[model samples]
Target: MKDVIFDDFQNTVSESLIRHKSILDIITKLQESNARINRAIVKSVTNCGCIEVNAKKQNTLENTNMDIESLKTCLSTQVKGTLCDNCRDVIQNEIGNNLFYLTSLCNALDLNLYDILLKEYDKINTLGKYSFR
Candidate 1:
């Protein structure tokens, strides 16, 4: 006789979730779990790169400094074509940052990014014509 703990797919899925509590579980446990997760990931990466943060204030300061550095590196460029360097950099960085933030938000909410974008686009398309002054 073989022992069958989870005989069906649904049971198996439940068992798996119980075995490995995921982001959903974390979110349920902590309202600000996503922020905590981001901070952990950021700090881990920074530590791995030999950056140390002894206090929360210091950690935030370092994180902000890094963000500024990233923006500086990404935003600094020479114009060579129709799009000016600063303009292109600003647009690109803003889009990239928003996409990154949205992606993280979706992950935290357990939402599919592609599907969300498709739905959002459909909604905008349904709005018909609109002029901005």
Candidate 2:
């Protein structure tokens, strides 16, 4: 009887420890995911010069030939020029899509973590009401 009780206690403790570890693992993954998303957001925002007044002004001239020549010169000088409207639109669309996907992923992970925590809480509460013996 004593051995059986000891085994039962050990199994209970083991299960609890496993749940705790799982929660910790999930939390760590969430933190890492959050950090990566934040870094990507910052990088995207920094790299996006499409909306700047200077870029708009540079590209506003009506002479396409002159613009092409200027772009050629700029390219020769290794200076980056404003993106053409089509390219700009494509990039903006891609950024929007990526942001949406990342937001959804984060939300899903958050909900999963919450559910795990709630389950763990309920298990602990139920365990608290029981006598080990």
Candidate 3:
């Protein structure tokens, strides 16, 4: 059910990648797309004033008895407010562009985007809280 869309999207990306067929171009474009996403997010905060980041040091505690769920409460999304319609639309488009470049890079490397996603999902699911640490 899930992979139906991913396969379709990957196929579409493979067909759309005309000018940036080279691996070098794909990688660089992927990075550039990422940068654009960051800029779009920052712009939503600074220029559009739709969202603001209330970032600070995380409340990570050293209590050996603290459960992972409890530790999770100490973490914050570090963001305040919500994006307005225009900002939301802009951010979503930038993210979509980033995904396009990412899929393009995967196609250039002869990789399956869905397979990579499944592998990552399996790793995180198996490792649980220890996935990142």
Candidate 4:
């Protein structure tokens, strides 16, 4: 076994861009990545059924209230960092809920998650302080 490190994630992402790529391709790729991460989190918890059920629940609910703001609220209230393993599980559940909502929002909006992320980076690079608002 050997130790290896990749110091530049941004550079790797930038270099992966190809010509004539459609926005749907980017969104599909992101959706796939999120699915994989969601699976890994579920596996780590030793309770795949729990996360699977959460995903179903998220899909059924009409989301008039969901965002990063809601995630922060849940994390602060339900899963304070000072707690033990049982409490940390609650935090993981909250995060899973947020992830489901965010992914669903992307799907509903027909927005390419990766393209949106790239545009945000471009804004930061070009507009700097103006992007803050």
Candidate 5:
């Protein structure tokens, strides 16, 4: 039973990877965005702005950080690595929850997530190299 489920999961992931270029593109962009946001937040806090003025911006940055963290977890689950049955189920659940969270974040931020993804895809396509980092 465990083997059957693992096989099915692998197949599902494989098909998704082949059908949707956005998955990899999104993962890459999320990583880059997270790093950039973190740096901006650090700089904002270090500049010693008034609390009242920085509070709202800080809150939004924190929320965006959380969303990025969730997206990272979702991307990790998509990695092709050996896993047991329990780990596989956990990864699947994490992926589902993170994806939901990311979608909500996109709506909240009024962001066209696919647009970001497509842009990333174009960059990768032009480079002809997968190693962006």
Candidate 6:
């Protein structure tokens, strides 16, 4: 069911992508979109003051018997507040642009966005906590 949405979005991007047809263009635009997303998030913290970054090293070893699962509870995103309506909207739009360019890049490479998502999903599910490290 959700796959239908991804397929539709990918198809739409493939059809709508007129200017940035080259893979290099698509990749650079994707990177720009990523930068916009980061900027939006930072603005939410700095300009709007809707959120605050309470960043610090995680005290994972406060308890000698702490396991991996226990560490999860102690870990923080370091974010201390929720996004206000304006920041949320700006961030969502930036993310949407990023996805559009990402889908465009996939189309240029003759790849299926949904399939890539499924493969990544399977890998994460299979690896669980060890998927990244």
Q: Identify the superior model by lDDT, candidate 4 or candidate 6.
A: 6
Candidate 6 clash figure, as a count: 0
Which has the greatest TM-score?
6
Off by over 4 Å in 4: 1-83, 121-133
Which residue pairs in model 1 clash with each other? none
lDDT of each: 0.44, 0.47, 0.89, 0.48, 0.46, 0.93
Native-to-model Cα distance after best TM-score fit, residue 20 in candidate 1, in Å: 21
What TM-score would candidate 1 get against the native?
Answer: 0.33
Give the alpha carbon lDDT tens digit for every residue of 16-126 in model 2.
433224555545544665666555434434665533222323442465555444654443322245655755565566555444333333343443333444577788788
| Alpha-carbon shift of residue 28 in model 5 (angstroms) | 21
Tell me the tens digit of each residue's lDDT in model 1 across 1-133.
1123212322333343442256654444344444555554344435442333333222333455555445445442232224345444544655544444444445556566656656767777876333111
Where does the lowest 10-residue lDDT sum fall in candidate 4? 1-10
Residue 29 of model 3 has an lDDT of: 90
Better of 4 and 5 by TM-score: 5
Off by over 4 Å in 6: 61-65
Estimate the lDDT of model 4.
Answer: 0.48
Best by lDDT: 6
Writing each residue's lDDT as its tens digit, candidate 3 over 1-133 gives 7899999999999999899899999889989989998999999899988789998987566677878888888888888899999988988999999999999988878899999999999999999997645
Whole-model lDDT, candidate 6? Answer: 0.93
Ranking by lDDT: 6, 3, 4, 2, 5, 1
Better of 3 and 6 by lDDT: 6
Residue-wise C-alpha lDDT for candidate 6, range 15-83, written one tens digit per residue = 999989999999999999999999999999999999999998888767989777877778888999999
Against the hidden reference, what TM-scores do the models get? 0.33, 0.26, 0.91, 0.30, 0.37, 0.92
Candidate 4 lDDT over residue span 1-133, tens digit each: 1111111322333354454135576566557656766665545445533322222223313555756556444432221123346545755765654444444445446545556666877889998655535
Off by over 4 Å in 1: 1-83, 130-133
Query: What value of lDDT does candidate 5 attain over all alpha carbons?
Result: 0.46
